[model samples]
Target: MSATRSALPRQALVFLAFGLVQLALDTAIYVGLTAAGLPVATGNVAGRIAGACLGFWLNGRYTFAEGGKTRLQRRHLLRFILAWCALTVMSTYLLASIVTGTSLQISWFAKPLVEAVMAAIGFVVWRQWVYR
Candidate 1:
């Protein structure tokens, strides 16, 4: 039991490393698109999709290394997609609403923050359901 419990932090660290890499890639893509004059919402959505693909690959091979090619992997990815879709809609709407409704003027930063929250949530769901 002690050995099993000790592995959790190591696994979490692996997950965090992969997640940060994924976030960096996604942020680069989003920023590039926005700099090229793409609208924030469009660019954000595109970045999220790209990130999800990379994340799925990383999580499947590394984060949940023990469960690759198993039924749990499939279920995890599917549920992740579902959860992401829901969060994406909520985050996008909330960010957009905040941008439009307030004088905060930090539109450039809001999407990344939202994505980070969504990613964290996704990690939890994936760890619990898919990688358990």
Candidate 2:
């Protein structure tokens, strides 16, 4: 029982570590595209797509791999794509709203904040549904 309890936190820690990397990649792409005068929605979608690809592989192989082995099956990828699509829509909408309601300068900071919130929700969904 104790081992099982510990496993959740340990897994969450690993997930968070990988999430940080994904966030950096996502943010960099978003900033670059937005700075180039691309629409916030376009930039957000592009960044999220890139991040999701890396995140799916990283989280699967390291954070949620069964028996400490990297074994990503087709179903996992399918589920991840579905979940990623939903999350991307939500994040892009939120980011775009922030940009319209505020300013691009503010949206630059808001991007990470929005993604951090999404990441929190993502961790649970990925653990319970996507990876499982």
Candidate 3:
């Protein structure tokens, strides 16, 4: 039990590290595309796709890394993608509801709250199945 508890914080730290990288890349791509005259929608989609790709590789290589070698095996990658997609879909609905059914303070709280829940879910899936 203690080990599991310890692992959770470690996992979260690693996850957040990769998440910051993803956010940086995503923001950079979005800003660059918009500056180059692309529509905001196009820039947003392109940035997200780029960020997702980066997140997968970074998390595989670093976040959930085990042993000494890289954890970029194809099976793990596929499972991670499937899990991430499912969680992302879930996040969309939850975020939409939060935005629609809440006051300003609550709505403002939606993103980090949703992201935290999604991160916890992702960590469990990754630790137990994706990278196991």
Candidate 4:
């Protein structure tokens, strides 16, 4: 338990580091999809797909790589997808709701905010369950 506790901060930093890359990929995909005439929700799906594919490898090899010294596996990949899919749905709902209901200008800002919130949630779930 003490060992796990000690590792948490480092894990979080690694997670954040990779998450920033994934976030940029997702955001770029979202913007491109939207520019191509897709709905925001559809764009969200595309972005999530792109990010999750990239994230699985990065998180597996780097972020959660210490767990059991485990290398990437099919089972881990499956769990990663399931975990990210859940996060994506949640963040998308938050983003969509905020952009639709709020009177704030620059709705694009909502994506980053929603992504940050989802990353926090993802770190807990990924650390405790998916990667554990």
> Which candidate number has the best TM-score?
2
Error of 3 at 114 (Å): 0.8
Off-target runs (Cα >4 Å) in candidate 2 are 2-5
Q: For residue 78, give model 1's deviation from the true position in Å.
A: 1.8
lDDT string, candidate 3, 29-105, tens digits? 65577567775445545655777788778877877775555678999988988887787667656644664687323
How many backbone clashes does every candidate have? 0, 0, 0, 0
Off by over 4 Å in 4: 102-105
Candidate 2 lDDT score at position 76: 90
Please say which candidate is ahead in TM-score: 3 or 4. 4
Model 3 misses residue 49 by how many Å? 3.9
Q: Could you tell me the lDDT of residue 73 within candidate 2?
A: 86
Between prediction 1 and prediction 2, which has the larger TM-score?
2
The window of 10 residues in a row where model 4 has the poorest summed lDDT is 103-112
Give candidate 2's TM-score: 0.94
Top lDDT hit: 2
Judging by lDDT, tell me the better candidate of 1 and 2.
Answer: 2
Candidate RMSDs in Å, in order, are 3.1, 1.4, 5.0, 2.3
- Native-referenced Cα lDDT, model 2: 0.88
